[model samples]
Target: MIAATPPANATIASTGAAGETASKLDAIAAQIEAANQRISSNAASIETAAKRLNTLEDTLDSTRKGSENGLIVLAKADQRLADIQAQIDATKQTQTTGAEAIANVARRVDSIEMAIAKSAAQASQHETVSAITGKSADTASQPALAAISQQTSEPQPRIASAVPAQTGGHITAPDTAKPAGDRANDAARTDLRIAEVEQALAFNKAADINTAKLVAELQAQVSATQQTVAGNTDVIAGTTKRMDTLDASMARMDARIADGERSLTANVATDSDVAKLVAELQASLASLDKRLAGDEQSLTDNSAADAETRIRVGALEAGTAAIAGTTGQLQAENKDQGKRITSLEAGLASVSATAKEALDRAIAAGKLAEGKLLFETVLSEAVAEFAFDKATLPKAAKVELKTLAEKLKAENQNVYIEIQGHTDNVGGTAGNMALGQERAEAVMTYLNSEFGIPLHRMSALSYGESRPVADNKTKSGRAQNRRVVLVVLK
Candidate 1:
């Protein structure tokens, strides 16, 4: 009976050990549940960050499209201006040709007038001769006088047609009726008339020469004006190209920043999740180690006397082996997560470094020039357009302004900013100019008040509807035209 009592005591001890092991397993199960909940929470955070990234990408894309459209409009405007200049040049050329033709016609008319005067003078001399010779002279000179009258009565067309061929010298028709003395006197009078006509032609020629000089000067002035317009167009084109490049760079930077943020969020989540897992695992291992150490001493004491105790000890050893394997797996997972975290952090650092390098290169290369486009962004989405005819800021506008302020602060340069406002051709010029002015002033004020940018550092101006980025005939174009531009100067 005494030997049976000791075996019963051993059975009681084995049952107690099994109960303790079950309690430890239950605790481990609870820890795994907590870890799963943490993982879920981290997953939700990652999803939220991803949604934000998508939204940012969409906004960036919209801004890029707007810029592209603006560039297209500028190119079209340049082409139209060139066409207008060409038409003007053609008109100037036509006017010059017309003036030269008019001068030639006027000179021919003057020559004909002199010819008429000489013919009248010859007829008068014939009449006088007829008076001196009485009826005999009258009969002799009648045919010559009739001929002179007929020549004098000739239409202007005949003189105009004949003048060019005979313009090299004075016009002459030989007369047989007049005596040698009278013919000599007629010759002297004809020479005097020719001299007077030459003087008038010389005066007309000088006037034509003066008119040509005036026309030349006007043409030169117009050409210079056209050149000025061309130069301004070139400047605008260059500015647009620079803006495009800057927008691309900004987009890339934004993408990299988003990527970095995602990576950082994932790393933080992974790190936190791994940390909790490691803590739980270490606690489990510590508890298991203490229990196993106690069980080992119990086994050494009980194995020689109790076969059942030995079997129970073997079961505990197997359970310990399983727990050890789990611990090893968890440690490996932790190590791998740590490596992944390191790699992610390195990737983030590389992205930042690469962006910095690119910015430095751009600055060194003078891509960011004085009076060049530093940054450009639409005021808001189509649904959230700028307040028309009002000097108020929208929430989206504030965000954009904040970004610009940050960029300006980062640059830390002694720069002057020109804030130009534009609008669609929907209203009267005066109204549009007023609206543009209000918007420009609003931007400038916001920059000064919200960002601590000095008022003296910025100037606000309005171009009204004159400098539209798009056509005003369409709804979409009007929306695009209502914009603000920032120009930087050193």
Candidate 2:
């Protein structure tokens, strides 16, 4: 019997499967490239949006500064208006006081003038009475005139007596015919009295002129104060109108600020949405990468299997050719070699059985290796919680790592661990990536140093802000994002 051989159809089928796998790999690669391009485009869009937001923020800041300056200027203007109004009130009060004082001075001057007129009338009437009574009243008039002259020594103190002294001294008492010496003395007294009366009238005229001048000056001052008050009133009114305009402007500014806030809020929401979409795309890319890795692994396994099958087929063909040569030699050596042929046939059957057994052992080994490969896929994952902006492992994370180490030690087969680090979106992409890497490396180092796990069996990877399990808008979500995950593969 001829040694059993794998079918040609089986080889063809394996080749087709390999070709199909290669084609799938090419397709997956193209898809991954497309995804990368899309990611780049999305990143550019996000950058543009961030720039726009920054510009809007700057605009709002400028607007706020301008508004504050406007308020300051308005406050200063208001203060200036208050000062002017105060000055106006003070000026008005001064004008009123000056007017009252001037009126009082005018009243006093009028009373003094009335007293002078009344005294002059009394002097004339006494003169008339003395003339009508003639010599009978001459003796009485002489004593009265002498008394009046004594009383009117100071004209301001005895205005009524001043007029009598003036008239009586000039009248010469009608005793000029008595004696030349007496008449001369009477004439001298009359001249002196006339001189005193003329001096008093001059003083009164001077007082009236001074009073009028003072009244004129006061009126001028009051008129100037009134003008100043009027100007101040106009200034106050203008200031008030300006304040009204400022108030309206401030109201408009407030409205604009409110609108800006609303716009900013809407932009924030849009940014959140964009972040979610990016996250989803990143997750899809990760899934695709995982699938691609699996496919590539399957392809490698299939290729190895095909190479082994080819090697076995080549060995079987060489053995079959050798057996055919021996059969031909035996047939050529003897015509009646039937027993020998039977012996050769038995030996060939034994060789075929050995080959069959070896083939079955090889298949069993392949199955075992395949099972090991299947088990080598990701087995489990655990979270290593970390604080915000910190790469240090927490106590709980250390405990978990310890447990993991123990589990790894208990396992018969070698285990590999992948430490994946992540971070919130609080920092720049590059910074976050660096931080994530540090966290991942920290976890890997802990596994190696504390648990004695081999460095070659662990790997550190940083996803940064690209991968997120929760919304980054909330504190708790951001905390959750800043974490390390250990993926175990056995």
Candidate 3:
């Protein structure tokens, strides 16, 4: 201190201070060097950690990409599955429709077969009746009478030879008187001849009548047979058409089923890929868990410096968590998409069922409309009633006829009326014929005047006792035979 009192030189003190500061700086530099080495090592470790984190992040990104791709593929697969399921449902519906159509066709085929059998039976019955009628008529005619005569007649007398009288010297013979038996025989023969002629006439008349009846019966039988055959043919054709439609529908269903099967097979392959992706994702998750455990242990070991490092660590953890949260959200979205696809499939099935029901109802309504039109047209042409005793309409009949006339006039159309009179066999032929004609004329006059039916549109016909429809032997039949028919023509 006494030496320093010699005078505190500023430069010297500054130099000393500079040396000490340099020394202190050198020590600080040495410590900083050590710190720098530690920091460099730490930086290297951090670089390595960063590299590992980057690698992990890249791996995570790859995993995330793969998971996203897998989810996208899963979504596609789910959509495809829905489409396949829809196709499968459609195929099932088509199969059901085809089965129903086939059943209907089978029923129609059975009806056709039954109609054919009935027609054949009726034709056979008609043939049998015609044969029996012919046999009975033949047995009651000339052949039986000839057989009776042959059994009752006696042998004829032999005539004398003319050459014998010349050889005995021309002896003259007196004419022999006819015997009573001969005369009786001659008269009987004449009566038999007349009776034979009468029998022939009766047989001819009967034959003619029988021939007409046979013709009519044959015609009716043929018509019935033809109608039955036509009906059977129509039924068969309808059945065949239905069967063809069913077959076509079945074919389409089969095709759809095959397509569904192919799609399911492809989906199974896709599911295998999805399984592989899940395994990879599990491996990635396990690796991330190991990394997180290492990070937690590193944080525990750095507890003295935890306050400073914790902020960075928390930031990194937060970043990793955010990434994980984003991945989770993506996975959730994929699952939701799959659900939506399933719901769409169910909706499509409902729509298909509704459409089929609507189509069926429409077809039924059209058939009902056509049937109603046919019924109305038939009713319009039908005869309501016939005249009481004559073809002539009563005053009440005229009133009813006028109503029809007014209806026709309202429709702006012409109507034709035909009056036909029939008589019972009780009356004489000429008298019945005259009465029928008079009744027909009376009806025509009423229709023309009261009903305002034009003369050109009104027609009248008289069928006498000859045209009786029922047996004259019975009172009920005779009453039924006496009638008039009124036909309305379109």
Measured against the true structure, the TM-scores of the candidates, in listed sequence, are 0.37, 0.34, 0.24
- CA lDDT of each candidate? 0.60, 0.56, 0.46
Which 10 successive residues of model 3 have the least lDDT summed? Answer: 373-382
Highest-TM-score candidate: 1
Ranked by lDDT, the better of candidates 1 and 2 is: 1
Instruction: Please identify model 3 stretches exceeding 4 Å from their true place.
Output: 1-178, 189-211, 231-235, 238-249, 297-490
RMSD of 2: 21.7
RMSD of each: 42.6, 21.7, 65.8
Write candidate 1's Cα lDDT for 339-421 as tens digits.
Answer: 32333233223323333443454456554455333333334223124765655767756765787789778989876666667
User: How big is the RMSD of model 3?
Assistant: 65.8
Lowest lDDT 10-residue stretch of candidate 2: 373-382
Candidate 3: which pairs clash? none
Clashing pairs in 1: none
**1-490, model 2: which lDDT tens digit per residue?**
1211212334345545657656765775676566667556656755765675576667567656766665576566557556655755665575575456445544443454464445445556766776787746356445555544443334434433233322322232324224434544654664565567556455555655765675576667657656755765676567667667766766776676666567666656766665676566567667766766765676566656644644553454456566566766756777544333443344345334433443344345442232221111110111344656778877756765676678668775665555667778998999999998998898889989997888877777787887665457976456545656555544
Cα lDDT over the full model 3: 0.46
